[model samples]
Structures are given as structure tokens and as C-alpha cells.
Target chain A: MTLEVADLQVHYRTLKGDVRALDGVSFSLADGEIVGLAGESGCGKTTLGKSLIRLDGRMRHVGGTAVLDGDELPIGDDKAMNARRWKEVSIIPQYSMSALNPTRKIGKMIAELLRARGKSYREFKDELVRRLELVGLTEKVLDNYPIELSGGMKQRVVMVLSTLLDPSLLIADEVTSALDVTNQRAVAETLVRFRDMGFVKSMIVVTHDLSLVYQIADTIMVMYAGRIVEKAPAETIIKSPKHPYTRALIGALPEVGLEYGDERLQSIPGKPPHLLNPPTGCRFRARCPLASEECEAEPPTVTVEAGHEVSCWKAN
Target chain B: MGRYFRRKLLIYGLTFVIAVSINFAVPRLMPGDPVARMLTRNSVANVESSEAMRGYFNELFGLDVPLWQQYFNYWGALFRGDLGVSVFAFPSPVATVVADALPYTLALLLPSILLSWFVGNALGAMAARNKLLDNGALPIGYVLTAVPYMWLAILLAWVGGIILGWFPVAGGYSFALTPAFTWTFIVDLVHHWFLPFLSLFVVALGGWAIGMRNLVIYELESDYSNYLQALGAPNRLVRRYAFRNAVLPQITGLALQLGVVVGGALVTEVVFAYPGLGSLLLNAISSQDFFLLQGILLFIVIGVLVFNFLADVVYVLVDPRTRLGLEGGQS
Candidate 1:
């Protein structure tokens, strides 16, 4: 395994109470595996992705151990984690529009950042140019400011910069959400190319657009209310989903091959539970179509097949 | 770039014409006669003598012409580089009087504005992340910025001049020393310069520090800064970028505040009784010297316009965003 997150719990501190964004979540990524973390908005997918690289100001690492390649990550201690960041693990953040400083030239800013991390920009210049080309960007972009580039160009520049050091794991948060349809497919394909070219050993592509992730992801993990509802091979989860939440989530997607003469898109009926002082037992029970009285007690994550796991009493 | 500068120059020229016209109209609108005040000061009680003197002075000062003709002549004479003679100090040309006083105001203005900006920005940047400095320096900056120039000048004069007797309370230099490029004259100039400069400097320092503190904090929380921090760029690197971006707004603020600084300098010079443009302005008003007042106001208008232009240039140099705009490129 390249990455293992065991019982990871990250909560957001708020005036009302602690928002249990990620409550006792356990998952692991295999070497060279690409896991698509799919969920509805505010379902802890973003919090989970951010936890692997960096926890923002409001997030509190309640308890967990993230072991990457036999070494434990110091996720809680921001100061100590600096040593692991960029060199071992890196991330492409959500706001790529304003990622680079507006006043700085792209090349100068990258050189400064590299110099701070005790790396020589002169040595990496060739590789940086090569990777920029890989992302369909020209060498002239280095001389330009972020504002000088088009939105798509800026996104590609940020994408290249994030994985320049070839970190073991790259957590891309909504990397393609800001793009149009054509650019979206292009950026998505670029991500798979980067992984195949060994720029990253493994990856976690976090997105709400399930179809986009399904194209590049080896496995899919569906999260509902900060806990994993289903984990299986990408095709298996889409075709033979056991959990009702995952089944409904896949059902809502408009598959291109399906014939639907008069059928409207389906949406999950109820809203996800409020994370602040959340109800006990299964978080998705209230929203689950097959919810039972047994769901009042916490359900075990049971293996339904060789590699498929579902956290529900009915699945057993 | 040249086109951009040409457009700026055209705008500045329009401003100059309007400002000069306003300066000409203001003093003439006052309810007083320059010749009457000039002749009365000589105490010429004989009617014939007073009338002869008033006529001679009126012609010499161009007041004998109609308002339209005088306005045209003012522009014509300005093109010829003649600012008229001072009625307050009759024999000296307006140019010479202004020249003599210009150095003192510049001395007070330059060091105070630039130094306060530098020190305040540094202090504010330090206070942004430091708990102790933020708590201590923030309130002091607020109070300092709130105090007006006149009140602060008087307070400084009382405390630093009268109470301690550390320096002379009034005048630009000691009575015994004349204007010369010597150590004694320079020392006396600095000694008398301290109070007015300090008053202007302290008052302006607070606003800059507070503005910079808030700007730096906002920049530190901005997406770029957060991205840098997330990439594990050290705090030092992250803050350097934040400061660079934060200072861009402060440069624009400096341009907007330049006129206020000039206004504050006038008040500060009045409190110290310094023989600068401010005191000269007061004397011109009392003596009804419209020519002298117009000349001084003209100088002030030019100073503010030039400084604002320089700020525009400096902003372009420091901020690439503006530079791209000037280059006719979209950002």
C-alpha cells in the first residue's frame, strides 16, 4: 500500500458545536492506484482530500494515523508536516484561478518557492518546461504573470507546478470544475497522463462530477456524511452497487448509452444530516431508501464480494 | 507606454488650467482691496498722495486692467515664466520668494512623508503576525492617526520646545545665523525643523501603519498566500509575497493622500511659525497680496500633480498588473 488512513476523524470547530466532517473513516490506496473520492457537497470529501495533504485553519485533526510507505505523516503538526509537503505529498487546491500571486511572474514565483524548499530552480528548469509542454502550455508562459494567461492556461500551469516534484500522492480538489466542457476533458486526460508517466505514484481525484472521475479512476469510494458508504472497483460500484445510497447516487447519473424517452433525472429525496451534533448510527439512514430499524445501531463495513465493501445492515 | 504617458499629460494639462483659474479667482473674490491695504500700511494721509500711490501700485500689479484682460495676461506671463512681484515684500519677485521658501517645505514634506510611510509599513507588517505588537501598536496607531496636524503640532511644541527647552519654539533658524551652506546654519535649521516635521510625521504614520496592517492581513488570508503556505513554502516566503501584493494598494493610497499631506504641511508650518509657504500665505492674505497668494497656490497645485504622477509611475513599476494594462494587454 502507498497510503493508509485508519479511522481518520477531522472535525470543524464552530461556535455552535464541532462539525463531524470526517468521523472515523478508514481507507487505503494501493501503489499506482487512482481513487476517485465522490460525494455530494459537504459530505467530507473535500475535508478528506485536504487532510491527506494539508488541513485548513478551521479543521481540527481529532484522531488518526496516516501511514505513507512505512512512514507516519505528521498531519496535525503543521510545522513538522512542512518537511513532508511538496517533497513527499503535494496538492492542487480548489481555487486555481488565484493560486499564483497576481504580481509575480510565473517562473520567478516557482523559482522562489523551490529555493525556499532547498531545491535549485536551474536544475529543475528543463523538467518544468517539459512538464509545461506535457500540459499543452508553451515555454513563454513562464515569463508571463498568472493574469496574462487564460483561465484554462492558468489551470494547466497550476497543475504542472503542483506535481513538478513527483510526489508519491496528489490530491486534486475539483481541478476540472472551473473549466468548460472541452477544457474539462482535456485537463482530466492530462491528469491520467501524469499518473501514467510516473509523475505521481498514486492519486485521489476529488470531485462531485462522478462521470468525470469514472473515466480515470481505478477504484471509486462513495462517502456520505463523512463516512464511506461503498468502496469497490470503479465498474463494479457503478454496475452492481450494494449500498442503497451508492445505488441511488449512480442511478441519478445520466448514462450516455441508456435510453430514457420521458424519464427525468432522479435526485436523492432528503438532505444529508447536519454534521453538528449528528444523529447516532448510520449518517445516511435518514436519506437511505432502504433504511431499516437496525440502521439505528452502527453498521459494520462488511465485504460483499472479493474487493467490495458496504457499510449497511441490509448488505449483510 | 508612450501613448499612456501622453494621455496622462493631457489630463494633467487640463487640471493645470482649471486649477490656475481657480487660484486666480479665489483671492480676487475676497472682500478687500490690495491697493487700499498697501497704501494704508504706508500711512499716507494726504488724499492726493494716497491716490497717486494707489494708481501706481495698481498699474504695477496689473489690477488696473479688466478681469478678462488680467486673466489673459496672467496666462501670457505664466508662459513667460513670470509669477509677478510680491506686494507683501514689494521689491522681491514672486519666484524668488517662493524659491527661498520652497526648500523648507520640501525638507519638511519629503522626509516626513517618505520616512513615515517606510517605518509605518514595517511596523504594521510586524504587527500583523505578532500578538504583542498587534495589541500594543494598533491602538497607538489609531490615536496617532486621529490627531490633526495643528493640535499635534501645538502639543509637540509645548512638550518638546517649551517644557524641555530642547530647541527653539519658533522660526526656521536662529536670529543670529543667516542662510548659508555651513554647519552652524544647517544645525540651526535642523533644530528648528524638528517640531513641525515630527508633528506631520507622527500624524501621517498612524494611518499608513493601520492601512498597511489591515492590507497585509487581508493579503495573508488571500488565496495566493494560502496556496503558498499549503505548498509548504516557509512563512518567510509566504509573507514576502503578501507584503508585495499588499503594498500595491498602499501605493494607490499614497497617491490619494498626497493632497492631504500637503494640506497638513501647511497647518504644521503655521504652528511652528516657519518661514515657509504656509506662513507666507497667511501674510499674503493679511496684506491683501493676491499676486503672492496666487503664486503660492500655483506652486502647491503643481507639487501635488507632479507627486501624483510619480505615484502612478511607481505603481506601474511595482505592480505587473498595472504594467500589463499600460502595455495594452488584458489581464
Candidate 2:
């Protein structure tokens, strides 16, 4: 295992109260595995990705232990986490288009960033150039400002920058959402290529587009209301999901060539429960079609097959 | 870059022409004639001598000609760098009087504008990082920015001059000594200059500090800053980037502030009775000295346009986005 997260709980400090964005979530990633974390908006997938790298100003790490390659991460303490970041763990954030400094040339900015982290920019310059080319960008891009590049070009630059240090784990948070279908496919392919080239030891690709992630992810984890509802091999999760929420989620995706004719695609009936002051039982109980008295109490996570884990009471 | 400058030069040239025309028309439209005012000030007792003087004065000042001819004559003299004679200070050319006072205003305006900008931006950037300084500086910045220039000048003059008697309240220098290059004269000049400069500096400082504080905070919260921090770049690196980006807008802000601050400097000078362009402007207006007023107004218009142009040039040099726009139209 490259990453083992146990009982992670992260909350957002809001004006009203603490919103439990990630409550009692536990999962692990194998060496060289790409786990796609899928969910609707506000379903703690992004929170999980951010938790492993950097918690924003509003997020508070209430309780958790995430050990990456036998070392416990200092997720709650920003200062302590600094030494490990960019080298041990890195992230290609969601805002890649505006990620690089607008005023600085891309090459100069990268050099400065590397120097600040006590790494020699000259030593990395050749590799940086190589990686830029790997992403189909010319080394001339280094001399240009961020505004000079197209959106997809900026995205690729950010990807190469994040993984340049060869981190043990890389989190790509909504990296493909901003691109068109063609660029999205290119970006997705680039991500898999990065993994195959050993640029990142393990990865968590946080996104909502299930069909896209299914193509690249080794395993898939579905989250609803701050908790992971199912974790299994990407193929198993898509074709034979045991959790009712996961089944409903997969059913909601419209297939490429399948025509609806007269009937519309199915959607989950009710919204996910509000995370602030969430109920005592299963988070998806109110939204699940197979809710029963057993769900009123917290459901126990069960592993029916070797790699499949489900947290629903109806999962047999 | 060439096209951008050509466009800017054309705009400034058009503005100058319109401003000069307005300057020519303004005093003529006023109630009293400058030649008549000069006659009354002289108070010649003999009617024949007074009539003779009036004809001579009107002809000398070009007031005896047709309006169109006078307008053409005004343009003709203006091109030759002749500002005609001042009715308020008779026989003295308007250029000579303006030259005499230009140094004083420049000394007061330049240091105040520059020092305030530097110190205010530094203070605002520092305050954005510290809560204690922010709490105190924010309200003080608000109050100082809201103060009128003359009001603050009067306050400073009253407190520092009348009550404390630490500095002189009026004039560019003491009446006890003539203008000289000696240390004593320079010291006395600075003593009288302190209050007006302080008033202008303080009022302008507040606006810059407030603008910069908000700008630095915004930059810190921007996506680039967040990306840096997430990548574990130190606070120093992040702040350096934020400050550089934040200062770009403030450069443009400095250009915009020049005209307004010039107006404030004039008012502050008048309040302290400092022998700068402000007091000269007052005398010219009250005495209806058309040539003097027109010359001063033209100087002010040219000054504003030149500073704005310099700001555009500096902005292009500092911001790559604008530079790219200049080279390739748009990205």
C-alpha cells in the first residue's frame, strides 16, 4: 500500500457552524494504483484530495491519520506539512488555467518555486524541458507568460510542474472539467502516461465524470455526503455495484450510443443530506430506494469480494 | 508599441488644443476686462492721460484687436513661447512669473507625491500581514483620505506654526532674508515648506495605503497565490508575487491621482500663502490677469497629460499582459 487513510474527519468552518465535509472516511491506495473518487457536488471527494495535500483556510482537520509510505502526514499543521509537500505529495489543483503567476515567465516562476523549496533549478531544468515536451508543449513555453498559453496548454504545464519532483502520491482535482471533450481525452491520456512513466507512485483522480474516470482508474470509490459508499475495482463498481447509492449513481449516467427513445435517464430522487448537523444513521438513507430499519442505525462496511467494499445495509 | 504610442500622442494633442481654446475663451467671458482692472489699480487722476493710458494698455495687451485676430495672435505668441505680460504684475511677462514660482511648486509636489506613494504602499503591504497594524491603520487611512487638502494644511499651520511656533506659517521662505543658495536660506525654505508638504502627503498617503491594502489582500486571495501555497512555497515567496502584482494597479492609480493631487497641492499652497503656482493662480483670477491665468492653466493641462503618458509607458514595461497586447493586439 502506498497510502492508508484511516477514519479521516475534516470539517469546514462556516458562519453557521462546522460543516462536516469529510466524516469518518477510510480507504487506501495500492502502489501505482489510480483511484478515481467520484461523487456529486459537495460529496467530500475534493475534500479528501485536498486533505492529503493541503487543507484550505476554512477546512479544519478534526481527526484522521493518513500514512503515505510508512510516514504519517501532518495534514492538520500547514507549516509542518511544507517540508513534505511538492516532493513527497503534490497536487494539480482545479484552477490550473490561473495557477501560474501571470506576471512571471513560466520558466522563471518554476525555477523560483524549486529554489524556494531548496531544490536546485539548474539540476531540474533538463528534466523540466523533457516533461514539457512529454505534454506536447515546446520548451519555448517556459519563456512565455501564463497568459500567452491557451487554456489546455496551461493545464498541461501545471500537470508537468506538479509531478516534476516525482512525488509518491499525486492528486489531480477536477483536472479535466475545464477542457473540451478532445482536450479532456488528451489530458486523461496524459495522466495515465504520467503514471506508466513512474512520475507518480500512486494517484487519486477526483472528478464527477464517472465514464471518463472508468477508462483510466484501476479502482473507483463513490462518495455521498462526506462518506465513501463503495470502493471496488473500476470494472466491478461500474458493472456490478453492490451499494444502492452506487447503483443509482451509475444508472444516472447516459450511455454514448444508447437512445432513450421516449424515456428519460434515471436520476437519484432526493438531494444528499445537509452535511451540517447530519443525521445519526447512514448519510444516504434518506435518498436510497432500499432504505429500511437497519439503515436507521449506522451500516457496517463489509467486503464481499477481495477488493470490493460497500457501506450499505442492503449490500449482500 | 508604436501604434499604441501614436494613438496616445494623438489623444493628448487633441486634448491640448481643446484646453488651450477653453483657456483663451474663459477670461474673456469673465465680467471685468484685465486692461480696465490695470487702469483702476494705477488710478490716473487726469482724464486725457487716463484715456491715453487705456488705449496704450489695450493695444499692448492685444485687447484693441478683433476677437478673431486676438485669438490668432494668442496662438501665434503661444507657439513662440511668449505668454504676454501679466496685468496683475504689470510689465512682468507671465512666463517670468511662472518660472519664478515653478521650482517651489515642483519641490513641494514631487517629494510629496513620490515619498507618500512609497511609504504608503510599504505600510499597507506590511499592514495586510499584521492584524494590529491593520486595525489601527485602516480607520486612520479612511479619515486621512476623506480630509480636504486646505483643511489639513490649515490645521497643520495652526498647530505647528501658531501654537507650537516650530515652523513659519506662510510664504515660501522668511521675509528676514532674500533668496539665496546659503544653508540658512535652504533651511528656512524647508521650514516653511514642511506644513504644506505634510498636508498634501498625509491626504494622499491615506488613499494610496487604503488602495494598496485592499489590493494586496485581493492578490493574496487570488488563484495564483493559492496555487503557490498549495505547492508549499514559503510565505515570503507568495507575498513577493502578491506585492509585485498588486503594485501594477497602483502604478495606474498614481497616474490617475496626479491631476487630483495637483489640484490639492494648489489649494494647500494657497492656504499656507506659499508663493507657488496656487497663490499665483489666486492673484491672476482676482486681478483678471488673462495671460497669467491662461499660462498657468496650460501648464497644468500639459503636466497631467505627460504624467499619464509616462504611466502608460511604465505600465507596459512592468505588466507582460499589456506588453503582449501591444505587440499582438490581444492574446
Candidate 3:
């Protein structure tokens, strides 16, 4: 296993109270595996993605032990985590358009970043150019400013820069949301290609678009109300999902050529529960069709198959 | 680049024409006539001599001509670098009088504007993350920015001059010495200059601190800074980037402040009775010296426009976004 995160609970300190964005989330990624973390907005998928690498201001890490390749990550301690960041773990942020400094040339900015991390820019120059070409960008882009490039180019540049050091695990948080359908596919393919080439040992692609991730993810995990509901191989999650919430989530996506004729596509009946002071039980109990007395007590993660895990009483 | 400068120059040229026209129209708007003001300035014994003096002054000053001809003559003389003669000080050219006081105003304004900008930005950038500095700098910056420049000038003059008697209250220098290039005269000039420069510096210092403090804080929260921090780049690298970007807007503020430099802090000059452009402006207006007034106003307008142009060029060089726009327009 490349990354094994157990009982990771991260909360947001808001004016009202703590928002339990990621409560008791446990999962793991094996070597060279690409796991797509899917959910609705505020489902804590992005929170989980960020927690693995860097927790931004306002995010309080309540409890967690993330072991990557035999070493334990200091996820809660910011200063201690600094020594591990970029070298062992890196993140491609959601807002790629404004990620790089606007006033600094792309080359000088990257050089300065590398220098600050005690890496020699001169040594990385050849590989940086090679990867730039791999992303269909010419080396001339290094001389240009962020605004000089199109949005897709900027996104690709961020991708190459984030994984340049070949981090053991890369958290790609909503990397494709800002892109168009064509660029989305290109970016999705690029992530898989990067993984195949061993640029990143393991990857967690966090996103809301299930269909997009379904095409490239080796395995998929669905989350709701800051809790993971299901995790399985990509095909199993789509073709034979046992959890009621995962089934409804799959039902919401329109088939390639399905004609509704008179009936509309199905959507989840109700909203996810509020994370702050969440109800004590299965978070989706109020919204699930399979909700029963067994769900009143929080469900436990049970292995239904060799690689499939589901946290639902009905599914077991 | 050439196209950008051409467009800028065209705008500046049009502004100059309109401003000069307004300057000419403003003095003529006053009830008093230039010829009449000059006649009364040095009274003659009887009506006959006064009438004779008025006729000669009208011919000499071109006031007897049709208004259209006078307007044309004003432009004609302007093109030849002649600002005409000052009636307030008969036999002295407006250009020579302005030259005499220009150095004093420049001396007071340059060091104050540049130093305040450099120190305020450095202090503000430092205070953005430093809690102790932020707490004290915030309140002081607010109070300083809120104080009126002229009011501050008067308070400083009273306390530093009248009560304390540490600095001279009026004049550009002491009455004990004459103007010279020697060290003694320069020391006296600096001594008299301290209070006015301090007042101007302090008032403007507060504004710069306030602007830069807010700018640096906003920059610290910006996406670029977040991305850098996430990558484990040190705080020094992140802050260096923030400061460079923060200074862009302050450059714009500097250009705006330069407009007031040539005008020489009118109220401050009046309060100190310093012989700078501000006091000269008042004397010109009261005595209806149109040439002197027009010359001073023209200098200020030109100074503001030139500084604005410099700001544009500097912005292009510093900000690559604008440069990309320029290049994108062509390619």
C-alpha cells in the first residue's frame, strides 16, 4: 500500500461551531492505483483530498494517522508537515487559473519555487521541458506569464509543476471542474498517464462529476455528509453497487443514449444531512429508501468482496 | 509599445490644450481687470498720472487688444517659452520668480514623498503578519490618514514654532542670513524646512500605510500565496511575491500624489509664509496677476500629466498582464 489513512477526522472552525467536514473517514490507496473520490458538493471529498497533503487555514485536524509507504505523516502539525510536502506528497489545487504568480514569468517562478525547496532548477530543466511537451505545451510557455496562456494550458502547467518531483502520492482536487468536456477528458487521461509513467505512486482524484471519473478511475469511493458510504473497483461500483446511496447516485447519471420520452431522469430524493452536529446514525438514513432500525446505529465498514467495502447495514 | 505610447501622447496633448484654455478663462472670470490692478498696485499722486500709467501698462501688457487677440498672443508667447511678466512684482518675469521658489518646494516634496512611500510600504508589509505592529500601526495609520493636511500643518507650526521655539515659523529661511550656496545657508534652509516637510510627510505617511496594509493583507489571502504555502515554499518567498504585487497599486498612488508636489502644499505654504509656488499663487490671484497665475497652474497640470504618463510606462514594465495585452493585440 502507498497510502493508508485511518479514522481521519478533519473539521472546519466556523462562527457557529465546528463543521465536521471529514468525520471518521478511512480508506487506502495501493501502489499505482488511481482512486476517484466522488460525491455531491460539501460531501467532504475535497476536504479528504486536501487533508492528505495540506490542510488550509480554518481546517482543524481532529484525529488521524496517515501512513504512506511505512512512514507516518504528521497531518495535524503544520511545521512538521512542511518537510514532507512537495517531496513526498503534493497537491494540484482546484483553482489552477490563479495558482501561479501573475507577475513572475513561469520559468523564473518555478525556478524560485524549486530553489526554495533546496532543489536545483538547472538539474530539473531538461525534465521540465520534456513534461511541458508531454502536455502539448512548448518550452516557450516558460517565458510567458500566467495570463498569456489559455485556461487549459494553465491547468496543464499546474499539473506538471505539482507532480514534477514525482511525489509518492498526489491529491488532484477538482482538477477537471473548471475545464470543458474535451479538456476534461484530456486532463483525466493525463492523470492516468502520469500514474502509469510512475510520476505519482498513488493518486486520489476528487471531483463531483461521476461520469467523467468513471471513465478513468481504477476504483471509486462515494462519500456523503463527510462519511464514506462505499468503495469498490470502478466497474463494480457502477455495475453492481450494493449500498442504497451509491445506487441512487449511479441512477442520477443519464445513460449515453437513453430516451426519457415521458419520464425524467431520477435524482436523489433529498439533500445530504448537515455536517455540523450531524444526526447520530447513518448520515443517509433520513434520505435512504433502505433506511431501517439497523441504520439508527452508525453502520460499520464491512468487506462484501475481496476489494469491495460498503458501510451500510442493508448492503451487508 | 509604440502604439500604446502614441495613444497616451495624443491624450496628453489634448489635455494640455483644454487645461491651458481653462487657465486663461479662469483669471478673466474675476471682476478685476489686470490693467486696473497694476495701476492701483503702485498709486500715482493724481488722476492724470494714474491715467497715463494705466494706458502705458495696457499697451505693454497687451490688455488694450481685443480678447481674441489677447488669447492668441497668450498661446504665441507660450510657444516661445515666455510666461510673460508678473504685475505683482513689476519688472520680474513669471518664469524667473517661479524658478526662485521651485527648489524650495522640490526640496520639501521629493524626500517626503519618496521616503514616506518606501518606509510606509516596508512597514505595512511587515505589519501585515506581525500582530504587535498590526495592532499599533492600524490605529495610528487610521488617525494619521484621517487628519487633514492643512490642519496638521497649522498644529505643527504652533507647537514646534510658537510654543517650543525649536524651528522658525515663517519664511523659507532665517532673516539672519541671505540666500547662498554655502553650508551655513543650506543648514538654515533645512532647519526652516523641517516642520513643513514633517507635517506633509506624516499626513501622507498615514494614507500610504493604510493603503499598503490593506493591500498586503489581501495579497496574503490571494490564491497565488495559498498555492505557494501549500507547496511548502518558505514564508520569505511567499511574502516576497506578495510585496512585489502589492507595490503595483502603490505605484499608482505615488503618481496621484505627485500631482500635489508642484503645487507646493498651498495651505502649508500659507501657514509657514514660505516663499514657494503656493504662496506665490495666492499673491498672484489677489493682485490679479493673470500671467503669474496661469504659469503656476500650467506647471502643475503639466507635472501631473507627465507623472501619470510615467506611471503608465512603469506599470507596463512591471505587470506582464498589460504587456501580454499589448502583444496579443498585434499577434
Candidate 4:
């Protein structure tokens, strides 16, 4: 395993109290593994990704242990985590268009960035240009300011910049959400190619779009509120979901061949529970159609098959 | 481009017409007469009577014509650079008085504006990066910004000049040296200008710091900032990227403030006893020097319009989103 996270519990501080954004989530990714973390908004998918890289002011890492390449990551301490950030674990954030500096030209900005990491631009200039070309951007773009590039071009530039150091694990949070359909496909394909080229050993693609994740993810982990409800191979999770929450979520999606007249899609009944003082036992019990009295107690994660896990009382 | 120029030209023309009309009308409508006040205060025994003062006013102001006609005549005179003679000052053209006062105001205001902006923005950026530093800096800025300009001027004079004895107490230049290009003279001039400069600097620095700090704080919370952070570009890179993009709105705001700065320097100048345009305007107002006041007001109106135009151009340059109607440009 290249990345292992155990009992991760992250929360957001508010005036009222703490909001349990990510509660007791555990998962692992092997070398070259691409895991798709899918959930609705406020389901802690983005929180999980941010916890691995850099947590902002409000986010508090309550309890978690993340092991990357035989070394424990001290994610709670900002100064201690700096040594591992760009070189070991990098992230491609959602809003990549505004990521570049407006005043500096693209080449100069990249050179400054590389120099800060104690690397010489002269040594990496040729490779950088070649990589830009691979992303379908011309070398001339290096001389132009960020204002000159289109949205898609800027997104690509950000992508290339993130993977420049070939980190062990890359956490991509909704990277394709802002792009057009054509650009989305291209950017997604570029991510796969980057993995194939050994630019990143493993990746966790966080998105609300399950179909897009289905296309790229080797494994799919469905989360509800803050807990991982289901985890399996991409095919098994899509074809036969054991958890009721995952089934309802997957059923809500609009498939290409499925007509609305033939079979109308149904969205999940209620919204995710508020993390601030959340309900005891199962967080999804309020909306789960299959909830039993046994679900009043916290459901333990069960492994019914090799390498597949589900958290529900009835998952036999 | 032609359309934009035409629109701007139309605005400029309208502004000039309105300003000139106000300049001509307000003095006529004012309660006191410049000629009467001048004669009453300084006239000899022969010029004591109201009839004699009326004759002086009529001859000096060309008051035989109708008010509108006199206004038109004044407008024509303005076009020809003949802002009529100041009634109080002996036979000097109003424009000459303004011209003499203009350079000093510009010299003091321009450098003060630039230095405040530079120092405030640099500190604001640094404060945005370091949270603990921001906690200390933000309140200090608020306190400084809250201080009135007059009070700040007095405080600077006392603390900077009296207690510390680091700078001179008053005046634009040292009387000990000639106003020529010599190192000793330049240093002395700078030393003299320091108090007035510091006064304006302290007053303006707070607004810039608070504005930039708030702007950076808001920017730091934006998704764009998160994107930069996630890229592993380091703290400085993230700050520069976020601040560069976020500071666009504030730039236009700062430009608008420049117009206010030119007009609002009165209190600072009075407290410092500095002979800038603000002090000159104050003197003209107290003496009811209508023609000089009109000239100064017209000059200020034109200066404000020019600065606003420059700000618009700068807005277009800093944010491409403005050109594309994505961010800075208003609907």
C-alpha cells in the first residue's frame, strides 16, 4: 500500500460547536491505485482530501493516522507537514483558473516556484516545455501572462505544475467540475496518462459526479454524511451496492441509455444530517429505508468479500 | 475605442461646464462681497463709504452687465487663461496664486500618497500571510485610521519634532540653505518636509492597510487561494497570487480616494501650517477671495477628473477579467 489512512476524524469549528465533517473514515490505496471518493455536497469528500494535504483555519484534525511510503504524516502541525507537502503529497484544487499570478509571465512564475523548492529552472526548462507541449500548450505560452491564457489552458497549466515533482500521492478535488464537457474529458484523460507515466504513484479523485468517477476510478468509496458506507472494486460498487445509502445515491444518477419515461430516477429523500451534534448510532438512519432497530447502535464495518467493505447492520 | 473616447470626452465636457458654472455662480450668491470686505478691512479714509466700495466692486467685477452676461464673460476669460485679478492680493492674477501654490501641494501629496500605499500594501500582504502578526497589525491599523487628520498632525509634530527631535517643526524647506541642487540643501529640505509628510502618511496609511488587509483576508478564503495552496507553491507564492488577483477591486477604490485626498488635505495643512493648496484654499475662503477660490476649485475639479480617468485605464490593465466582464468590470 502506498497510502494508508486509519480512523480519520476531522471537524470544523463553529461558534455553536464542532461540526463533524469527516468521522471515523478508513481506506487504503496501493501503488498506482486510483480511488474515486463520491458523495453529495457536505458529505466530507473534499474534507478528506484537504485533510491529507493542508487543512485550512476552520478544519481541526481530531483523530487520524495517515502513512505514506512507510512514514507517518504529521498533518496536524503546519510546520512539521511542510517537509512532505509538495514532494510527497500534492493536490490539484478545484479552482485552477485563478491559480496563476496575473503579474508574472507563465515561465517566470514557474521558475520562481521551482527555485523556491531549491531546484534550478535551467535544469528543468526543457522538460517543462516538453510537458507543456504534451498538454497541447505551446512554448510561447511561457512568455505570456496568466491573463492571456483561456480557462482550460490555465487548468492544464495548474495540473502540470502540481505533478512536476512526481509526488507519491496526488489528491485531486473536483478538478474537472468547472470545465466544459470536452475539456473535462481531456483533463480526465490527462490525469490517467500522468498516472501511467508514473508521475504520481496513487490518487484520490474526489467528486460528486459518480459517472465521471466510474470512468477513471479503480475503486469507488461511497460516503454518507461523514462515514464511508461502502467500498469495493468500481464494477462491483456500480453493479451491486450492499449499503442502502450507496444504492439510493447510484440510483439517483441519470444513465445514458435509461429514459425518464421508461424508469424515472429518484433522488435521495432527505439531506445529509448536520454534523454539529449529529444523531447517535448511524448518521444515515434518518433517511435510510432499510434502517432497523439494530441500526440504533453504531454499525461496524464488515468485510463480506476479499478487499470489499460495507458499514451496515444488514450487510451479510 | 472611438466610442469610449467620445463617452469620456462628453463626461469631461459636462464636468467642466458644471464646475465652471458653479465656480461663477457660488461666489455671486455668497453673502459677503470680496470688494466690500477688502475695502472695509484695508481701505484708507477716502474709501470708507458704501458708495465708494460699490463703485470699486462694479469697476473691478464688470458688474454693469447682467449676471448671465458677466458669467459668460468670465467663462470666456477663463478660456483665455485670464482668471480675473484677485481683489485682496495687489493686482496678481488668480491663476498666478494657484500656480505658485500648486507645485508644493503636488510635491507633498504625491510622495505621501505613494509611500503610504507602498508601506501599507507590503505590510498588509505580510500580515495576511502570518496570522499572529495580523492579530497585532489589524487593530493598530484600525486605531491609526480612526485618528482624525488634524489630531494626527499635532501628534506627529509633538512626538516627531518635540520629543524625538528627529525632524524639523515646520515649513517646506530650510532657510539656512538655498533651494538648489546640492546634497546639503536637499537633505535639509527633506528634513523640513518630514513632519508634514509624516502627518499625511500616518493619516492615510491606516486606510490602505485596513483596505488591503481586508481584501487579502477575503481573498485568502476564496477557492482560487485554496487552489494555489494545494499546488504546493509555498506560502509566499500563494500570497502573491491571491493578493495580486484580489487587490484589483481595491485599486479602483484607491484611485477614487485620490480625488478625496486632494480636497480633504485642508485640516492636515491647517494643523501643520503648511502652504499647500489646502491652506491656500482655506485662506482664500476666509478672505472671500472669490476669483482665487474659483480658480483653485476649477483646478481641483479638473485634477479629480483626470485621476478618475487614469484609474479606469489602470482597472483595465490589472484585471483581464474586467475586459472580459468576468470580475472587475461593472455591468
Best by DockQ: 1
Q: What stretches of model 2 exceed 4 Å from their correct place?
A: B259-264
Q: What is the per-residue lDDT of model 4 for residues A1-316, given as tens digits with 9 covering 90 to 100?
A: 8999999999999999999999988899999999999999999999999999998989999998999998998878876787788789998887787777666778988898888677899998888888888899988988877777888998888888888888999988999999999998998889898899988999999998888888899999998889898999988889988999889988998878856896668888888899898898988899999998999999989997986899999899
Task: Determine which window of 10 residues in candidate 1 chain A has minimal summed lDDT.
Answer: A282-291
Question: Candidate 1 vs. truth: CA RMSD?
Answer: 1.8
Provide the lDDT at A187 for model 4: 86
Q: What is the TM-score of each candidate against the true structure?
A: 0.96, 0.98, 0.98, 0.84
Q: Which ranges of candidate 1 are over 4 A from the true structure?
A: A257-263, B256-264
Summarize candidate 3's per-residue lDDT along B176-294 as a digit string, tens digits: 89998999999999999999889888887877887888899999999999888888998999999999999999999998888668987788789888888988989999888988999
For each candidate, report its DockQ versus the true two-chain complex. Answer: 0.79, 0.76, 0.61, 0.31
Candidate 3 local lDDT, A40-60, one digit each (tens)? 999999899888778888999
Summarize candidate 4's per-residue lDDT along B113-147 as a digit string, tens digits. Answer: 87898788877877877888789977888888897
TM-score of chain A of each: 0.98, 0.99, 0.98, 0.97
Candidate 3 at B322: error in angstroms? 1.2
Scored by TM against the true chain B, the candidates give 0.94, 0.95, 0.96, 0.89
Predicted structure 3: lDDT = 0.90
Error of 3 at B50 (Å): 2.4
Q: Where is model 3 chain A poorest over a 10-residue stretch in terms of lDDT? A: A48-57
Q: What is the lDDT of residue A6 in candidate 3?
A: 93
Clashing pairs in 4: none
* lDDT (CA) per prediction: 0.89, 0.91, 0.90, 0.82
Badly placed stretches (over 4 Å) of model 4 are: A143-150, A180-182, A262-264, A278-280, B1-14, B36-80, B103-108, B130-133, B151-197, B242-264, B309-331
Candidate 2 lDDT over A64-138, as tens digits, reads 899999999999999999998989899999999999999999999999999999999999999999999999999
